[model samples]
Target: MSTDEEKSSGSGRLLTGVAWAILLTGLWLWGRGAADGAGGASAPTTGDVAAVGRPLGVPLPPAREPLAPVGPSRVEIPSIGVSAPVVARGLDAAGAVEPPPFATPDTVGWFGTGTRPGAAGAALLVGHVDTSTEPAVFYGLSAARPGETVRVTRTDGTVAVFTIEDVRVVGRDRFDARKVYGVHRPGRAELRLITCGGTYDGKTGSYTANVVVSAYLTDARGV
Candidate 1:
């Protein structure tokens, strides 16, 4: 299949790409218990949220109608102090979605081929967990709890407001692509903020798992 850069106009489409499929497949190669490493300098994951998931009594707002397709320009999550520019990123040579460049550790990269931020499907926004010497834009991503707000400013000046529905530290061995990357609801516009989590492996230069934050469009407004 051709790459997003070659096949997309940033239209609305359900999350499906050879790159993403291959990506989760690769992550699935690691051992099942990789989410809890046996020996690593990696810090233990923690969060302030106390049972805020939808099943736990957190009231969620109604989903707004999916908007016309438009590229996202920025992402802001006040609960975790994330305000970063969004860049369109394509697949690497391995046919996996590429993260933002390390040179710009504070920027979030959008999968240009998949669903737009406020469109009918789930839009993916990925960021770095850390750099060589510093915490990156998504370093605090896991700290974000369910019921928080994630605002995506689109190119058309509409802000797609989403409410956090779930947060998970997905182990590489159990990387369920449909749960981690698929649409949360059939017609609701959804968003996902992903970053490295679990434990960091100095040898592999990557994390053992991923912090996946799931949210759905609850509101929409201009500016």
Candidate 2:
């Protein structure tokens, strides 16, 4: 069986990238309000977010789309102990969204262009668990289990709590975009958490499988 840490092909990269970007943008947007002061309702202050060191590499594969801001703002998952600054951007060369690393967890990234985490559709969040030099910001994410709660603190000061419904390890080739990216029921919001897991392959410089977590809105306030 392939490990969860493997690098998926086109679809995997897109799926993982999009999810991470949304979560990452949420964090960034939470800290910075819009120019017109719109959507700053409950966003987090820059002081509340964690800082980080410089990025690792030049970020291979040129960025494909222009970087865009995230929705609502601020992403907080207290259960997982993840509170950090975020930066949003559009897709890059590999067609994956990129989020900047927050200071706390060595480094964390996101997908700049994708569904917002607490939106009506399947919101995605991606993060690195670890790298060669250090433990990644989301390294503890694998511990997330079904029935667990994921709270997304939006810019409006409203909080959306999602209940973990499913968690699985899938091969990159078997990734299903429609199921993962498609919209949910009307007025209902969903979220998908993704990360590389299983085993790392030095030859490919990626992982063998992907750890995917699915969550649905259980509660929300202050939209």
Candidate 3:
């Protein structure tokens, strides 16, 4: 069965909760870096950050076989001009998908239950819009419009192109998980990109809304 998180009442509380979780992640990244001598003369590179970095061709050992020509696992939106690698991770018992690298505790990725970009079901990708000091890769996602293309590069060297269908900015308190994760009609595969958006509440420490971009897979290979 598919599991969806319940809607909340106030974005303030949700943001606060996320901030606390993200803070822990930040501390962990710092601590791990220090222990690993991240201060080395080499200077930090993309590999240093959890989900924020340049796209590389290095293969993850013991790779999961392709589920339909999964591309490079890198995503690109030509309209906004964004291209970044996406990692996949299982959800915790709490069912909360991890935040992006910039959000702290550095747990950016999607829950594995959803389909990959070119596959059958809805595929969800989550990222942080920004943090206390830096803007994230997906910060301008709310501006994407219908007809724009969202490209996914799979591990098997194929690209899946998705045409944007719509965009919405929903309050975190009212995020609708069912609508976001619900199965799609036959012949149509959906992709959802999510990121923090709207004003940031310093006191509560979270964004007022989440920017969601919905798209339908238009082109695929090896399916």
Candidate 4:
């Protein structure tokens, strides 16, 4: 197969792996919740969001013109005390976006193939919510309120300032790729910070939902 075909195949597999992971996580959460007699209620099935909680719809800030592209070196969220080095990552063997290693859970992973930070597209950054023992860099990401600032330090010694527009904890089953991963405005530079959240299932070793913080570039300094 050609290189492009290989990438496509890998991406397809990655999506499959993500879906299976979500399903297995839900099942495990349900079984464990039932076994623990936590309210003596059966665990909700996959896509059964009655117990997963409602989706949040935080208002976005006004769109602005895009800035020149620049590679990111670090990400900071002063509101939640997050400061981490940013590393570029591609799909894993399973085709899902490879997150920072568990050993270095404090680091953040950027989808290097897509739009660079401060550019006219959605730049994706993902990190672990927590390791087995402690909270990761993005653990408090969901608590970020609208209008907060997310600063991305670029390799060019400039900081791209993004203002938070929305924060939502979306269940894995109901995840909408287009809405969560797509660019809202054609010429606006946006950033997405993602981490796992919601109920944790020991059996599945995964969280029931993903916390996505959406922001857009409002200003830049040292440019």
> Which of the two, 1 or 3, has more lDDT?
1
lDDT of 4: 0.65
Clashing pairs in 4: none
| TM-score to native of every candidate shown | 0.76, 0.60, 0.64, 0.73
Give the Cα error of residue 67 in candidate 4, in Å: 1.6
Give a tens-digit lDDT track for model 1, residues 106-220: 9998877677898877677887676656678988988888789999999999999999988877766555555456664577787878776676544443456777788888899
Instruction: Give lDDT tens digits, candidate 4, residues 164-200.
Output: 8767776876754544555655667888887767776
- Alpha carbon lDDT at 168, candidate 1: 78
**Model 3: per-residue Cα lDDT over 1-223, one tens digit each:** 1122212344322333463244223223332333222232221122211122212553222212224624236788888868787787544455444444433423335544446666655567776665444456776788787667888878877777787765766555544344333433434556778766667766565666666676777775544
- Pitting candidate 1 against candidate 2, the one with the higher TM-score is 1
Residue pairs clashing, model 1: none
lDDT of 2 by residue, 49-160 (tens): 2112123442222111211223535555566777644444554454334444323443333344445656554566666765444556566666666666777665556676
Ranking by TM-score: 1, 4, 3, 2
Q: What is the C-alpha lDDT of each candidate?
A: 0.67, 0.49, 0.53, 0.65
Q: Kindly report the root-mean-square deviation of model 2 from the true structure over all alpha carbons.
A: 15.2
Clash count, candidate 4 = 0
